[model samples]
Target chain A: MSLFAVQLRREWLLLVQSSEEILNPLVFLFLAITLFALATGGGPDTLQAIAPAVIWVLVLLANLLSLEGLFRRDFEDGTLEQLLLKAEPAFLALTAKILVHWTFSGLAMTVLAAVAALILYLPVSSLGTLLISLLVGTPALSLIGAVGAALTVGLKRGGVLLALLVLPLYVPVLIFGAGAVLEQMAGIETRAQIYWLGVISMASLTLAPFAVQAALRVSLEQ
Target chain B: MSMSASLSVSQSLKAWWHKLGSPRWFYEISGPWQRLFGVLALVLLVTGTVWGLAFAPQDYQQGNSFRIMYVHVPTAIVSQSVYMLMGAAGLVLLVWRMKLADMVLSAAVPFGMSMTACALFTGAVWGKPTWGAWWVWDARTTSMLVLLFLYFGLYALRQAIPREETAGRACAVLALVGTVNIPIIKYSVNWWLTLHQPASFTLTGAPSMPPSMWVPLLINVLGIYCLFAANLIGRLKLTILERERNTQWVRALVREVSA
Candidate 1:
């Protein structure tokens, strides 16, 4: 099998073996939606008003909660060193890890976000925009978050530091992702927001692996 | 010592200037310039602050509170600009492996932090009167806070890494990657229809400010630039001393300076 495929399979197994990692973020997503429903009096109008931001913020926090393990396990078990030394380019390996990260966190967030959108009374028409935005934007999060994870891989209590490093970088993705849904809700053409989000994701995909590779080299060097 | 000799001397000076692309040459030559700029910066800062605070006119709308702009606007501008400077340093460090680039990155952080702090403080003070609140989560204010966090992240990442070269590379990558925020900070108002006003100053066109308002702002900005240069020099010197302590030249220079 190709290295990328093998890496992806291995990561899938690892994520499955740690089911809580996958389930916890979904729970957090559900709980956030629930809290917003309760706190805002379960009024559809109010929930709809704040739903885009609430959903985006929840996804952000969920991804952040999962990011610490992205590189920590490999660094701890010496697998990261092996990957670094492999003949295959480190950027490719970084890309594979990011793919796995997105598959687990980003894909799960997409599913849970759909459910959350329904609960929040997001318009039926806006659902397509929400899903498309998440599909494009979430991988960008994983890709950028990989750089943060690689940089903080072996540090003690890296979770908070990882959030500190990665969250601000997520703002553009948040702006566009949430903005797309808002635009759709407002009866404007949402194409520009999606196009910008796609552009950002493409730009980040092209550039972030190098940063991840550089950061991983530094992490392993130490 | 001859006329042709003088011409050769000027040529060599130009050659040396060209070689400043090397960190070692930069470290060697920047020592004296650092001290000179440091003194100049201190003078400019003191004079500018006193002139700005004591002499600049109150805004027609903002009154004495407008004087806070003397500190706030300049620091806010410098905070973003310094992030770009650090990113340039990061690019040099990554592409060329210049140790001075690492030093430049390190030198920039404290200055960046101070500038961000000054901006936040002045923003808060200005907000109290203008917005009727000490703080608001407006786009500009929120993004400036995020910028502060980015600076802290760079510093914290540097501390977390155990090896110097590793730290340098990691922080450099982080700096380059995080620089996307600078433009966002600059245009957040335009992007979101934000409460914060769009930029008052522009390069290609006339400024929004009347002459009375802009002249002192221009001076204050120049003064802050001078101060940033001075602080950078001091920080770079300390970085050189720390990194080069084992070297003979550093030891000799230390002895000479102490003497």
Candidate 2:
């Protein structure tokens, strides 16, 4: 097998061994959706109106929570530096790591977001739109969040700092991702919003890895 | 003959670039330029404020409140430009490992952040009489707030990293990332219903307002750019001294000043 494929397998096995890595953000998304429903009086009318935004925001936070540990383990074990150094072709290891991270965080949150949307009384008509938006948008969030993670991994106190750095970057993704679902609910054409979300995801997928690689070097150099 | 002349010009440009890399050379050369910018900033700012606030024609619609554009427009212009400047500096630092570039990046942030804050404040103040609210999540205002948050992130990231070089490079990465995201934020934010008026000045057209109004605005914009330059140079000088304090030139300069 190619080294890149091997790296992917290695990352998948590591994540599976610690299954909570995948479960944690899903659980967080579910609970946060419930909390939002509770805090806003659980009225179906209000929940239905605000459901897309609420779910999108919670999904963002869930991805953020999962991202805090994206490189923490490898960094702590000195494996990150080695991985960067010797991963056959450069960036494949980091790419594999981010791909695995998205699977655990972004992909899982997409599934959980559907459940969260239903719980918030989202219209059944809009369910597919919400799922599609999350599936397309959350990987961009993971990519962006990984840049923040790589930047902060060397710091002793990085949690709050990570959120502050990454959230502003998340604004566009949030806007388009949630806007798509909201537009579908309003019976407006959501093609533009979905296309923009895809554009953002594609842009991040291409660009963010370079940033992540540079940031990881900065952190490791320290 | 043309080729030889071009070669010589390029050779001089290369030499000048290397000279700028030396902190002491920059310190010495910028001394007179800083004074020049400081004086120009003060003179232009004072004249523009007087002209804009007192003598310019009142708006046919909004009356004297439109005069706030003198402060608001220049600051908003400078804040965004300063971010772009820092992003360019960040690129230089990351690609070329230029020490002075990083110093310029660090020096530009607080000034840029304050300019953003000033723009937002003046924007809010202007909004109250015009929009009937102290704040609105209009496209411009919301994006400016996001810009402020971006500045805060860079500021906090710099503070969190203890090592100076590491901090600079890390902030460079963050700054470049922010550069990429700014347009996305602007475009996304514009999807909201916009109440803030479209820009009054356009490069391809005459000013929307009379020269009596836009001239003062033009003056204020020039003044603010000078002020920003002066501020950056002043801060950069101090950063150079502090960073290079152990070096002989800095010590000699200190002794010369003290004596």
Candidate 3:
């Protein structure tokens, strides 16, 4: 458990030092929203109508940008090899890595989403749901993305392939996450969307660790 | 025979089954089975298609365009089922280190991709009449498109790596990871509000279709399964031949075929 904490701390420090990795996606999120505004004539009514989808699409793209590093770096540097050989289970180590990735990438996206929401003129009432949805939903993204990353860890030019593998799985998360914001904005009850989001996150959290462990073993064997 | 003697005979059969985990043994054994399935598949497919396309009732909603279901539903069903089948084979290969399982995974790819393409094309044809558009980003259609991409990725992974064993393991891992998409594709409409309709056919639940409509559909589904089995066996044989060209049995088979 202490090892996991140390690993988490190490990942955080790396994320902090690599400001571009953290900041680039945020930049993409804002730029995409800005482009949408420009393309659609910057009308408040139009922006509000498209805000939930645009935000979710941006989040998906931003997540794609950071997904490559989830396992590629560790696998390349021999760190993953040592971890595989460690006495503590690889799944725990992988879970901690995914958690750290979510904290840095997913949480950062959530913060940027707030600014984008304000710019897009989303109703003030929906802000809490949007934030909460991103908070609960992005970890699921990282966890599922970890499976793709681990599977493609040893392959050459695997970035695009990883996207192909992971994006389809991202549908459920995208559906429920975006639905929560959309429902809230539309003045409907978002309880069902929130429930589904929680369910997706919980399910991924439980299952993805085993998948990552299996992938990491195959990867390390090679 | 006494019970103990019968048990011994069955135990030996199980031992032989385990030995068939070797690619060479599987390749040799499946040769006759492949031919048998190939002929059976051809007969079933021809019969089912003729029956469904010619004899079945036109939909009150869709007219003759609904005839595309004969091709579309079977291909879609096989496309999804084949992925599950391939993923299961991949899991066995990865976990058990069975070379025969690797050959099965390889064999399953081209068939899966062809089925995916058939589904997509037939879907477009069906959509033109029903939806008044060639395409929509409906959940089912979108997920099927993604499934096609997954197949391409698996094929590409196989091509990129030089070592057969390493390639097999890598592709297996990708296949297993990609299995997450299968259920989402199956339940995408139920899980989220989408333009795609919910499932019409289920095992335990009541079907949306009447008996006249669905009986041919079942026949077509079985026909597709037979076709997949036949194609898979053919592909596995070719894969084994290519991979085992240096082995004595392959050499003998090549000489025999050429002669």
TM-score of each: 0.87, 0.95, 0.91
Candidate 1: residue pairs that collide: none
After the best TM-score superposition of candidate 2, give how far the Cα of residue A23 lies from its true spot, in angstroms. 1.5
The Cα local distance difference test for each model comes to 0.81, 0.89, 0.81
For each candidate, what's the DockQ? Answer: 0.52, 0.85, 0.51
Most accurate candidate by TM-score: 2
The candidate that achieves the highest DockQ relative to the unseen native structure: 2
Model 2: residues with Cα > 4 Å off, grouped in runs:
B1-8, B194-207
Q: Pick the candidate with the highest lDDT.
A: 2
Clashing pairs in 3: none
Which digits, one per residue and each the tens of the lDDT, describe model 2 over residues A59-155?
8998899998899999999988888898765576777889988988888778777778778899999999999999899889999999999999999
Ten residues in a row with the worst lDDT in model 2 chain A?
A87-96
Cα lDDT for residue A78, candidate 2: 91
Docking band of candidate 2: high
Candidate 2: C-alpha lDDT: 0.89
Off by over 4 Å in 1: A1-6, A13-18, A38-43, B1-28, B46-51, B54-58, B184-189, B194-208, B253-259
When summed lDDT is taken over every stretch of 10 residues in candidate 1 chain A, the lowest stretch is: A87-96
